[model samples]
Target: MNFRDYLLPADSPRIAAARGVTPAEYAQRMLATEKAQNLQREWQTLLDEAFRGITTHGKPQPDLFHLQDEGFDNTCAVNAARALLATLSDEHHQRVCQPVDAQQWRAWYNPEIPFNDFGVRLEQTSVATREAFRRLLRSCTSPSGFEKINHLMDANHFLGELYDLTNIMNRWSFHFMIFGEPSETRPWGWNIYGHHVAFCCFIIGRQLVISPTFMGVEPNIIDRGNEHDAILFTEEERRGLTLMQALTPVQQQRATVYTLMEDPAMPPERFNFADQRHLAGAFQDNRIIPCEGICAAEMSPVQRQLLLDTVAAFIHILPEGPRQARMAQVLRYLDQTWWCWIGSCGDDDVFYYRIQSPVILLEFDHHSGMWLTNEAPARFHIHTIMRTPNGNDYGQALLQAFQQYTEAE
Candidate 1:
């Protein structure tokens, strides 16, 4: 099902009525909630399977012969040590001591820190070393004879300390999100913290040469598989790129936007000219495009003609421009004429395609605008859609363009 379908209201009165109740009460009353529950169950099943393999292969215990104490055959101490070591090597120890890096450590230990703050801490260590630190700390312990256990603990917790600095940095990086007077502040802070933690954990795993059951489960965790196995891009990338390609040269010059798409099922033939219309239709039907204002004031008559001509060739043409003057002002924001594309899939039938590129697509409804209802107070909407090889949504074609453009240079 489409994402919009999920967002839209259902026709069932029982379901519609439930929406009025508190989320807790609604969940208790709805059958549709089972979908989420079922999905969770499936996720847990996969996790259990992956964990089973990790435990069976990654258990940290010694062999049966090693369990026999060499010097303390008669002492109970040897047996105790063997038991302790076995427990440590058990599945739980590896799970807790899972390799992590500075980013993942910060995230797992200090999610309150901001990105800018985290970046500062990251500056103190190389990505590789930060990962090593996470592994060391995860397994570190103070010996009984050590007089400076406290100091040792402090040293061990340095990664967490660095994460604290990240919190301060984050506050500065996204001051607007943090300090804005909105009643409900966005959880950008928490999101960054979680991302950092995951990234750190990934780094630790990499340094320790431990493999995660999932891809991108850790930071710097490169996917050694084919591009088709990646998950970074989504349908959103395609929609974004389509709009980006339609922008006039002036528009491309000013704005800096990045698009990312993740679709594993995207075959090479999907980029052919014959498939362009189908792709364009998919974007439009999905309504994944974001609406943003465009200024077309700066375009000379010839430039405007070129844009219209280029766009006209595509099956799906998104209109551009408010007036000649507005187009000129909008052209100053775009930075580069580049796009990125990727595709990947999962173990299931699920698939995705991602396209990251420059594009501008904006929408403004009347209710949100300053002016109340007016007879003709600019009630129009502006849309800029493109689907040509050069116009955007041409993933495979762009590769060819890049090669040709580079060869010519």
Candidate 2:
């Protein structure tokens, strides 16, 4: 029999009573609820099992990766579950589920700012999510391991953010539906939906390029603006501003932010001081240099090289003309200060440079294209980072870079 044939009817009074709705409404609600609940339960079960395996072993198991594809499926499943819950009368599911309070709803819905404002403590929650994801990571033994499961947890986290944002936007939409006539608020609601869709695509697509196995920087949401003005800035912006404000006057004018990953064994001071003066000279010559405050952390040299090569190749393969010029301009900006560098004790350093000013109040993913063979084709894999002009407190580097350029004359 077809699945629908065996499905329970929605018009049943019993189901309605249990759901605190009329018999007709209950029947329809149950049909959707039952299916959604079933899927949710199954996915949760798989996730739980995966988590158990990882915690018990303290290392990822091979089977865990197999379940990574479920990340997308689980997102759909959760959405369905949320919709099913919405159909039920609030009276029925008061214990297990409650409609988000105004404060909670606000926190959940607003994506323009960081999660802290909403009281969603990521560090604490991630401990649990990370453990669950650990199991999923252990399962990958194939070449596709990174490609398949590496970013599932990050994607899942993003989905959670999306869910909250959508819920908030939906609340606004409902208000319009009730009051009658769409207005500016209504457009805002639609924009939220569009934003969420775009973000979802970005998060999912980015996973394929820099999965957990690759050891590259993970994307993070540093700052999200208020609902009325939702904007996202890059991590580059977050760190750059601080560093810029700390630079000397001469350095400030000529300085730009560059992100470099050096061997952990190499002292950060060594990398920063040793390279700063020389790089500043290069910048005077219109050459790109490392940013101040070099961040040296543990990362695989091979992974670093792959990222750099991909970016370099991206620069080399662009079509000639206006597009190329624009790309070049962005490249020069990125190259001047934005650097993703990796090094090992014995291996050569690998670096990726960009001249494009990092987008502020927006997220850009580099992983989506039909050309699978193209370098850096994995667009969305790079985590969200931001760049902005130095504010009063943190823009000295911008001044330094500029001053250095002037002194060169």
Candidate 3:
């Protein structure tokens, strides 16, 4: 909520000190002093204005997509979102969903953000409704994609056990929300968000853009003997290493910015001091990151494949059709992309790598302690994100393009 309601009077000592005013004889200061900055009004204003344009009702399609062609087919996903909405009561519908243009679209936070008041918490919802929501998740993402999300949740629960926190930190504490009406012809999106995980999937006709995705965890492994080899972020870690090894000395020299990752004393070129470990992380939707590391065109054929494969590890999370469409875009921009790295290229070294292109930006980093006790950044702590820079995240760009195309036609 807006904090304006709790604002102190203008004449308050703290306010006077901040404004460099001596609170002259309780005079005109009263006018400005009494106006305590509160957020309750502004908060509601944002809520009411969030999704004012998107239609309240929508239908299947209006020639915005050609699912039969080389693009995407979102019929299943569209139906699933509609099905989930049908299962909800009017109260739940109002609470759990947002309009396509809602500001809540940008309100998502990974574990990095402490705000907990947004989105629909699945565990807090009725059982029948929760089950129906999962069905939508299943329909939108592949089985493997859904599995990875659940694993992240369970890892959050595991962390809670170590930290002695409440059930709010449990595996099922994830939040869900839909933006825009579920219509085949219209552009809309949904988000599944919570600690250590935030998936922003947007749909514009037959195209999908899943970006500003945040995936990370503490104690990145499940130590339970029951589920042996329960690990996450390994493919990302391994593929990044594979690409680094495939690079020649000259290429590595261009890509490797620093041997000691995140060292404050390191030169500005060696590390991004602002983000510390990961750039384009949470709350960084508008970060301007110039190309770093070596371009894919500079790599050997094998190294290029490794780079593309590493990218696939993130894009593969999309359903088959959308994944293929997005992968095609990655290939189209292969020459323009940069593959940069920090930290060690040694066999067992904690490191960071970023892949950025005109259409995509992916970051993988081994971070130091936040939830864990590790002082040095380790393989056990991982953070990875896939973003579409240049304001295309959430398919907003594509939606605009589609609108223009139809208007011109």
Candidate 4:
């Protein structure tokens, strides 16, 4: 469907209502809605489950992740972190830094407005500090990974321009915070989140884990003819659809968990206003999402390779070393992996699909518009999540392993 057909005029009631209000005021107004309040209550209930972490069944599978030296550039990452810290004054430093295991790591939410204001909002920071954080990002991610992330930030700015809402969705609207001290031999991390982007990276020695990552876009492009123009998720969408089409008719039938994006037969919890068809989005740290759809063990060699390629599209976000390590873990657990789909896989259709295994949980969903006015899920609006399940999200499992090793020593 053409998203332009769904665009809300600047003077439309919704757009007009949000205009001129500060982002905080808009957040308060949005959060005060009965629907938003209900979501918050439900999320808090999930948060109280003690964070055993994401699992297929109720219990976490043990030894799914182990600490090993992967040759990550931890020294460079630490140096970048120190540079960022050096740019901050004492007061700003205190606010932007936290312990490695800080609870605020789980508090990141993906919306334009300030949600709790827990870190240094890039828009409010000096240029030097923002550049330092960019260097930190470059240090931790592959070159392509870094570009994709900055592309999302630029897309956010374009959205703000689309609605004349720079107060809320500008490129620098995100929050950047460091966790733990800059140490090559100890665990530490960083978080950057705003609008449709959120990334939490945890590092321990030469091992690195970047999970509980959320990247999405509305309209999926910044085509106003400028340096920031981008069209996202093309490969991610194409690869998944190709895999689905490659399956046998029977396999396709089994892999399709639902026949429609908003299937009436789904349980009430299957879809929500904020997360749509994604069960692992913000605040779902310990959700017990049972495996659905066809197993990879059921695939032929050709189709199986297609499946791996599909997953690699999302896994490419990691630096080369960490990407290799993560893919190895995924390959090791191939027999236990599941691939599931919602809605048709037609070229023009909007849909959602997931790849889940003991070591990973990846979700990509087409969503109904929020800022624009589309009332149905559209290909142009997308949300994708990557999580290391069975207790590895936010690298909590790795952190626990580090603690155990330290105690034993």
Candidate 5:
């Protein structure tokens, strides 16, 4: 169903009773006017800002993988890209292909609201075409990583069928775009984006970065399904909660916000501080947020291990070697990393937490339901994101530094 359909008019005594507001009040107060407008503008302004210094190069960047000697083997990735190119018709290519530097790469959203999707949609194409795209995705990500992503699509479809809103919420509603040529020696990437999920897989030589990645869902459990009962993201949710539970009372005082995920019964400052929705969500590719909350250096050995394990839940999405390399970098900076929490620490309470380091920014949140009837924040509706900060999203910052170093040499 269209996102707006869920915002039932708070006019009927029944509806009004649910939201605790009148019809006119429901329409006005329920919508996120400023945030939505900001997201729209972020898309409009991305090309000029996040990618400001980019030159108009139609091919992949030659030196994009200069620092890589291990951790990536793009044979499968290259063959898959070529296979996709060969399989697609000219009309499909024209519809799906985008420039390597297109701002479209930065246009990803996981909000419960409906938005337009670019590139090729799965349902609009032939079965062969859809299989080719899946092959391309599997070629790039780890087996488990790919499974998590695919299951999310299935869960979306399951919800669609349950609600009889399959038209707007089908599993095959995703879109795919290939930027630059597919070559093992150069930089090229692909993005598959749709409701509740978005991934940017950028590869340069044996190196890859999947940043600005988004994975979220409503009704995170499937009680009635036999075909695909997806209980996903619970590890991520549990690991975060474990760390919070392990923290000392003094540490809890340092991290807790004394607020709930829902902004109700709170002042504007609280919502502004933690955000009415997600803080480091999509369209925020260029945020320059500094570290906040407690640093890892202050944590005991057990807390540090818990922190490392939590980071692994996000980093393990990469292929084996890259995953190891990335974790090494994370370990190197563990002392510099920061962890913070917002809302109640109890297991039953919905909350938010962020894990930040020089190279990583991870956010896990219990969100207010948009599809389900729940009004207060619930564990069933969740939003989680992983970003490579300091301009490395899509590996732009790393490529730039590599370019400068080569010029000097």
Candidate 6:
């Protein structure tokens, strides 16, 4: 489908309303709206809840994650982090660094203008600082992962160009922050977040945990006939569709949670304006989302491989070593995993699917337009969330284990 046809006019309410305002001003106005305020309150309540972590049920299963060293050296990443910190002024450095367990790590949000403005915003940074941050991103992620982030950011800029809203959606509009100090012997990592993207990484020695990541886009491509032209999410979108098609008719029937994206039969809590079909977005650190589809044990070997391939689209954000470690973790829980879908699996259909296990929770959703004015879910507007369920997100469990071992020693 051509996304260009769905673009809103320059004078449309969504575009015109924010034309003269700065990103922060626009954020203030949006946050004051009833819907935004209500969501803020709900987020506050979720955060206030005791953090047992995201779970398939009420309680987290024990000993699923440990503090074993995975032999993945991140010395280069640590050096890059130091480089970025070195480029910052003392006042900026203070704003850019936080304790490993600081609450800001969990405060990430996926909006064009997020209300949580506690990090070093790239747009406001000097050229040297931005370059240093880029080097750090390169060090921390796989090559393709870094490229995907570039494309997502560029797509944000392209969308801004489409509606003349660059003030709020520029390519460099992301916020970056370092958590704890950069160290080889200690645990620390970084978080970068903004419109349609949020990634949290926590590391201890040779082990790296990158979870609670959110990546998405509207119109998913930059088609200006230049070097910047790019597409996003094709692998993820196609893999999800392929897996759904590979299921036998009976298996598909069992896996389909609802035949419609917004089914009347679904409970009220199943969908909402901010998150739509996603149950584990920002501030949902401790949500109890029960499994709702066919278990992985029911799949044939080939079908199971397809499921893993689909998961790899999300997990590939990690470097090769950490990706392998994560895949091994997911594989260990295969029998207990569940795959579920909402909406039809027909080719070209907009839909949502989730893969949940004791160790991982992934949700991919095609959402109704927020700026372009589509009243129904569309392929052009997609949202995907990856979380480490059962107390491992942000590597909190692993960090706890490491701390205990070191303290005892």
* Per-residue lDDT of candidate 4, residues 55-124 (tens digit): 8788899987888998898999999999989999888899999998888788778867565678878887
lDDT for model 3 comes to 0.70
Candidate 4 off by > 4 Å: none
Q: Give the lDDT of residue 84 in candidate 5.
A: 80
lDDT of 3 by residue, 293-377 (tens): 7899888889999999999888877888878877887898799889889888889988999998777888998876655545567
Report how far off residue 320 is in candidate 5 (Å). 0.8
Candidate lDDT values, in order: 0.24, 0.24, 0.70, 0.88, 0.71, 0.88
Better of 1 and 6 by lDDT: 6
Q: List runs of model 1 lying over 4 Å from the truth.
A: 1-11, 14-17, 31-36, 49-352, 355-409
- TM-scores for the candidates: 0.19, 0.21, 0.79, 0.97, 0.83, 0.97
Measured over all alpha carbons after superposition, the RMSD of each candidate to the real structure, in angstroms, is 24.0, 23.0, 11.3, 1.3, 7.1, 1.2
- Residues 1-409, candidate 2: write the lDDT tens digits: 1111222345544323334333234334534656535543543343333111111113311211110111222233233333433443344223223221111211111121121222212222234333432332232122232232223323323423432322222211110000111121110010011111111001111011110011111122212243322112223233333333343444433322332333356555333321221221100111222233221122134433332333332222111331243234343434232322221111122222222222111112322111112222121223231122111001222223334556898
Q: After superposition, how far is residue 238 of candidate 1 from its true place, in Å?
A: 7.6
lDDT of 5 by residue, 160-190 (tens): 6655555556677677789878888767889
The residue ranges of model 2 lying beyond 4 angstroms of the native Cα positions read 1-326, 332-409
Model 3 backbone overlap count: 8
lDDT of 5: 0.71
Task: Give candidate 1's error at residue 272 in angstroms.
Answer: 26
lDDT of 6 by residue, 215-237 (tens): 99997777999987887888899
Each prediction's number of clashing residue pairs: 63, 55, 8, 0, 1, 0
Pick the winner on TM-score between candidates 1 and 5: 5
Off by over 4 Å in 3: 1-73, 112-116, 164-166, 227-229, 265-275
